[model samples]
Target: MFVPGTASRPPAGMMIPYTEQLIFTIATQIPFVIFFGMGIRNLISRGDPKALLFGIGGCLASAYEPIVDVMGFCYFPREGNWVAFEAFGRPIPIFVPATYGWYVGGMGYWFWTVLQNPKTTQQEFQLLWLRAFIINLVLEYPPIYLGIYIYYGYQPLEIGGFPLWFPAVHAASPMVAATVINLIAPHLKGVKNLVIIPASVMAYGMANAGFGAPVWLALSVDRGYHVSYPAAAITALMIYTGVWIMSLQLLPTQPLKINGMNGNGKSKGLRG
Candidate 1:
């Protein structure tokens, strides 16, 4: 996506040293840096333990993203020549750094804060999630629709032996990761975790389809695959509606801690 206008074709992917890659990768993934930075700021301003946890979550998510990319484990095209991990006899994906940063700096940390404070009955958290989801859609939609990444000659992951949705379904990786983190974080309930799974899936699926990334490339870039806009459209709608419904059902139950005993001098799980 960062190719300069004058450069019609990409250079042969090469592996720079980790130190060099670190500098460039950080520079390129600005959105991710900002996201993590915001998490830190929230931690200091609000002094919410959850905010700090979210910052840590961002770092962890950022770390894993590159591994997924490097191993070609999840999906999407890589940008540079393969870098191999010495212990593992395989090459790493080129887009690992940027994609990982995108996850942590953008959504991972934010999702952590929300999950830890799910008891928030106020509209702020709800509205924030909605806004974040929308921004993600807006930023991601066009690359797939226009086949912009494909035109750059990167080979994305294939589904059913065909190129999956443009920009690739793996774009939902962070959403999936954050949801998993939420399930394990303190104060979460078994039931809420179960409910969040499908809801998140729906949200990501709808977002991918609705904004852009039609079932097939509209311009016949991959003519082998048949276009079925109806199927994609319907799936997206179902996912969006499903996520919305579940979110409503999972009402917040915040302020989970109790400070002391009840009138009977017995332990009570009630907020002071």
Candidate 2:
């Protein structure tokens, strides 16, 4: 339900220097370079190829970026930037997908690494979410500061031109993918790792669109619906947060290390 004239378009005549745009685009790939490098090293030495597969998958997953931006009321600039692809009257920048691949793919790889630890605790998982949230805030801030994009509309909990709601969902998507991949990666021995390429993309969509359905629906219905955008935002935030926390609690528990007891201290599992 894309309502015409509802998107918050960047102001006309707004343009970033092409040099600056190029610089930003290259800078965003630093993490991808590092992560992809690590993935290669891991593949050669440890035979673990999840990271590499995820990086490639993340690059492909950028297709979802334009779709979500339309629903989320975001408008990426096309005036003086490298346009990756256009959709629904919006021209997304190349840097947008670059960040998605590096940020989501890289972070998802890292998060899955942590979840791989047999000694991981529930607290550690929550910490991963917090860290991703903060990193997302930092990554997104630079583009907005450079006038490369804008989040327009009754965006809930916006600060410094970026909305808080964006980071919450942005950060959670990688975790969702990482968690799902962790459950199945081990059984995929040898060439089996390649299968996760498409699966990771599926997880990416589920994490963003599925978990974010509440807010997406809210934004779509905000035009004439009696419900206020902020109220709908608040409700959606609670639901997203609630489901993530529940996932943490309900997932299988690790062999916790309490008071220096190491993995021997099994304690009461995650569900309890």
Tell me the TM-score of each prediction against the true structure.
0.41, 0.82
lDDT digits (tens) for residues 1-272 of candidate 2:
24465543446677666877887889987877788899899889998788888888887788888788887777766678688788777777777666777788888888887877877777777778789889998888887887777877666677899877778877777787787787687688878888767877887787777656666666666553344355556655664575466357436756667765558554444443
Best by TM-score: 2
* Model 1 stretches astray by more than 4 angstroms: 1-27, 34-95, 102-106, 115-134, 137-148, 151-180, 187-227, 252-272
Q: On residues 45-112, what C-alpha lDDT tens digit does candidate 1 reach at each position? A: 86533433433443334333333222222223343334422123233434444444445334544654
Which candidate number has the best lDDT? Answer: 2
Worst 10 residues of 1 by lDDT: 1-10
What count of clashes does model 1 give?
7
* Candidate 2 TM-score, C-alpha based: 0.82
**RMSD to true structure for each model, in Å:** 11.7, 6.4
Cα lDDT of candidate 2 equals 0.74
